[model samples]
Target: MTYEPELPANSSPADAASSTHKPLHHKPVAKAIHPLNQAANAKWVPINKSFITLTRIILKSALERFGLVNLAITLRCVTQQGYRHLILVNDDRDIQIAAVGRVEEFIISTEMPMTPPAERLSAAEAVTFPVDFQGQRLGYLVALVRNPRVDPGDEIQDHPSASDIKYRLNRVAEEMVGVIKRYQTRYRAIYVYGDQCYWIGNSAALRQLDQRIDTLASSALPILIRGNKGAGKIIAARALHCERHTEIVPFIESGCHEWEEDAATSILQALFAYAKGGTLFLRSVDKLSGENLRVLQAFCTQRTLEKTTKGHAESVDIIFSLSRRDAELPASLQRWLSINTVDLYLPDLRERQEDIRDLTRFFIRECALGKEFDLTESAWQQLEAFPWTDNVEGLKRLIVQLSARAEHPLVDRPLLEGLMVSLD
Candidate 1:
């Protein structure tokens, strides 16, 4: 259920792609996001006023004008045939990106300004301006003014700062477009390395994990990444490899459960050779049989690259990812994995709930394909309330589900149960 926006299809920003690993920026980031953020910007509706910080600030400044009490702007979706509503009032309420109709309703309810300035401003206390860019009517800017006692005239011309409001607002609309462009390019501080090895989130847990990843990437020690059946462990390994190398390096992942008794040693040796001078991720090694585990332990202890026929002492970083607690792993394998090894923990979605919003935004932007779609605040409330025990991967799946069911752009509270969420 991808809803089209009134904007052109976004292209990847040239500066978004990075070769090395980077930590997420805690400060305001530059106008550089990888394809991920650029992609999300299409579906990236502003959830709060701080979204387009500079634009909102300038618009708020306009609100500081004496006569004006409310300001609303409707932006024509660039990719599709629709509009987006933005509102700024002289209050502390942070508004979300609303639909075209939503803004119209608010304007009508308050008798605020709307588009196509009514012919002959008689007894009118409001002004409406078309937000135009490059001859395109992007949307409308409406400002509702309370009659100040200074002027008894109902006409806008009677206000001392009428012309000033118009001039400053027009300037604001101009700056709005520029600021939006900047935001669309770089709204997130995500660190990405290809599709498989990028981390997203602002959670302390994630940041701490990142510090650990950074610390371990340089070491030659074997790593045991234990997570509670969630996501990002392998991705963590990929990030580690990325931090360890500037050039493209082989990153191989094989499940330990797939190893058979007859061919376990052969498969192990093959994986090592294939990922020489790179990283090999072994998933769920706790599932390996005791005999196969011993096979691995012996092979890892004895074999250096120099001992083999094709060996030159080539180093391969081995990372083991399992979905169990350290205590749960077989004692023998655990001893082998723990020997002078780094133990990295991947927190599941439940532990990193704080990052859910950003994760949802990222996934929506990726899946929505620049369409003007929405999950309303109420819809979001329900979504946030659901415990996604499956982790970030589960949240992604749910967003994808919602995207699939959207008949139009908006997914509101009433539709949540029937349309997307399914506990069974």
Candidate 2:
């Protein structure tokens, strides 16, 4: 049985009038019957059973664990629309109404249409928005306004007021699309390497980083990720490798500062062997000695030459991370980086302050498990005001600590202030 909202016994005048007119194509079906009754009806038994089973699966799955249903309901409420339909299109181009809001007694077609209706509704003049993610159209949201004004066919359009309505509708649709796409994307737990996942957020910096990773992932050139300490450069590097290479390749990581001059060459040789047909991530390369830097440069040059001449399919892709802004390398090393590497800069937590709330929520989910705490307005202001010197790592640590001592359901100003003072 398809679930829909309940309607009042004494309907409004508008509802009575709408009920009088039959829909353009199909007659309105009987008020949604109980699942058992739907099963008893021979014609609808298979379809109804399948739909119920699918809904139960989705409800239990991780896809619906997020706020997809809540988002649809919220969008419908915010728009003040009497009817809202969210349709999900699968890989095989099959479309199904995944969710609906305020559409209790409406006509629903039994058969799937051959093609989805064009973005605009012609009969009733409703606007449709495509829920797109990463250039792929996953589904659409159609919101129908009650008693919509008819569009007159004219050579020149003269409706000035329609523009404002269109703008508001477009804005709401955009917001709904964003919410859906964010939940659908695997940004929270992207596979990075063996037994590790990168937590990529929805901040603008990370969005740009995702784009850069897509652009440079398949290239043979070196990649240099620059950021402050604890700014997730290493995670970004690993995510890039996971995204670009189709085959499972080894990820060999080393800290350049850990290598002494005498052992640098031997260590690099061993790393090269381990990193064949895969990625080699060098952390804190800015701290390497001049001799060690030269050794790296020579290795890179040799690999580049060998790849060009021998067509080695097992060449290693080098990725370097620089934590300090003022760190300098030798002129030759700098020149090589400039010529052979793609530089990606990750902004500090202070730069993307808007992401603090989302990061806090993520940490709460991770650290608190079932127990949750709400942050008061003043507490949020305090968090925003403080400079995150250690970036996301520091924020996560603070959240974990706060969740441990959360006396009240809400984290208020006094509690946050005390924690901040203690940390200082």
Candidate 3:
């Protein structure tokens, strides 16, 4: 997994994490790594946002009822270099305290807490209550007691017995598991291919685009597609091609920069030939040099010219794209383009904000390969607020890291903040 720049010494969480196909409890783990000591190899995924939030809500209610001050949830992570460590997932803030001594001792100690000295525990008032489930370790729990029992070793009466605490923790953990399941169900993807990604949502913008594609798919008219980077212009072109021909056909993609003045003739000839009875998508016509623009101008004008003059093939569906940010093409060029091709403006992320959640779910499904994933509401807000300057392309890149960084399926605000801050 990738990491951001080393977080400051005092601010980061200790290392530990988890994953599973069917309750994938990881293998053995190293005790704990110093905040400064994030190993070169650590297999980690962040806990889901919902999972973490639900966990905190339930765990806090249950544990605090009996006066426990803090806890640490450690999950196992393995490195590509063959190292193992029980990376800490929940931070001190989430669990409510450092419990530093207890966690560190639990991680490193082979012996049980009863076999250890007072200093091995946190503040000597904390005791390590540990559990292991389906081979995954529940490292320790710390209960801070202010008053001493009359005969402390004989039978402590203040807090619930260890069995009662275990019962409560078990109930809380089970509840969190339900949260994880819900997340997985909610975010599952219906469309995964980049070409089909924009079609995954049901927003009005998407529905209109879908309708437009249907109306124009078989018309064989030259067309223009406009969007920011990764906004799925090429996907639009592909959709047109697929709708027109049920069978697979050639779809050649080239940028306007490739339309050299020196070779415009040969390149156009080659592209149309290769795309015969198929589609040729040329992007960024606005990027063409003035001389090159004249060549495209002549070409489009001919496409609009009478069949009495030499003209390009009727079978080739040639499409062009321009950045929506670009100023409009010159009047004469726009006139011919308007006469010969339909203008199709792609909606920007801002315009399509309503579809962000669905698209993110689909992309995460693609990245996580069906592993359950959940993000907190704030994390979802962070995603929506992101400029997505690179559009769908940038969103996918961010999700790949987001999926791998969490040891569990849940992605919370802090985990996302760490990643987003690094992007700046």
Candidate 4:
């Protein structure tokens, strides 16, 4: 087992020291200098200059950056030539060995088969820094010195004092914490809607919707989505499937209008065959013909029966999207839904008017492609007051038109009004 640096909230210094099999201060001496460290020393680059360069790289690769690797590399380049091991622990209690200097075997042999405690632990051999953002603890960063000749008991005789090492490690840990917080903030704002990707709204309704989607994603039950046209039913379904399964599970989609003819059986058979061990999304399921309805009913019944006895049989999960304007579902379909499916009702844009500003900002950002723009108060009011018949879909189209026609970075009331008149 890999050893972590965390300790219990109530753990004393004695308990923390005993958790690790051996003290962290002891490390095997280096036979030869590492090439990277040697090159770094030759240039004699200032620590602040190297830190600034590393920060720029982290910002540019924000989305793809791994915190552990970035922190490890930065610490190794800035510190003195000694064996250094960097360990990072995440909020989920997952431990990552970010970097191991020349003496990897010595570090592994000393720290393996130990579990991290819940609280922070420190020893004379190593230092542990708690990484926090806005007062919330994110993780712990531990750095161990690898020089075996350095005496833990007699620190005054050591050439590079332990105080110097601690100070450098702490500074590097602070920079790493900032990068992690920024990455998390960006991830929460980003969202995808069908082919168009935009930032998500922060309204209460949107938060609830996200929570509901998360709960439904992990279950095997059928899903019945009811919403107005262009209210994002299909997007929700796709998001649910993507979150639940990691592998490339085939997602087969078909419109019920396509099955209005007599060839419904063949189309459904092909769809079912394609969707085995995956998901089948039926668009406007209420428009299905009587024959198609019977076919679906029988299919659901057979699958239900098979699931009862043969637990390991491959089954297709059905997701039905229906417009609120459509007629009530047939009694048979209703029974199947009631017995083995969850119903999700999406609110139209008009119902959640508070989200208009955030949704507009997201669309504007997508259009600008990182260019900054400002919307006037009156322009924002105009957007929030409008009755969005097409829900989020209509709002997106309007933003695209505004982006195309606006001559300046400032989107004022008059410019917005002029565009609205032209679109009308």
Strongest candidate by TM-score: 2
Instruction: Show the lowest summed lDDT stretch of 10 residues, model 3.
Output: 25-34
State the TM-score for model 1: 0.52
Residue-wise C-alpha lDDT for candidate 4, range 225-283, written one tens digit per residue: 88887677766666555545433355566666655444444445556555666677877
Q: Estimate each model's TM-score.
A: 0.52, 0.59, 0.49, 0.53
Name the regions of candidate 4 deviating beyond 4 angstroms: 1-194, 197-199, 218-220, 309-313, 325-336, 368-372, 421-424
Clashing residue pairs in candidate 4 are 6-117, 7-117, 7-118, 7-119
Which parts of model 1 are misplaced by more than 4 Å?
1-197, 304-313, 325-327, 418-424
lDDT of each: 0.56, 0.54, 0.53, 0.53
**Across residues 1-424, which tens digit of lDDT does each residue of candidate 3 receive?**
1111111233223311111112221221111111222121111222444344444554556545555534444333333333332333334323422332222331222223333345335554554454443234534444433234422453445556657666655654444333332222222111111123324444557656766766776554678787778777866776665555433345566676644443443345455545555567887888777776776667655544533353333456677888664447788767766787787777767567877887788778889766778899999999888777777777777888888787777789888888876554
Candidate 4's TM-score reads 0.53
Ranking of predictions according to TM-score: 2, 4, 1, 3
- Model 1 per-residue lDDT at 127: 71
**TM-score quality measure for candidate 2:** 0.59
Lowest-scoring 10 consecutive residues by lDDT in candidate 2? 38-47
lDDT of 4: 0.53
* Residue lDDT tens for model 1, 260-284: 5544544565566566666678888
Query: Which candidate, 2 or 3, has the higher lDDT?
Result: 2
Per-residue lDDT tens digits for candidate 2, residues 298-386, read 87888888877663456878888875644677677677778988887878887777678867887898788688788999899899888
Q: Using lDDT as the measure, which candidate wins?
A: 1
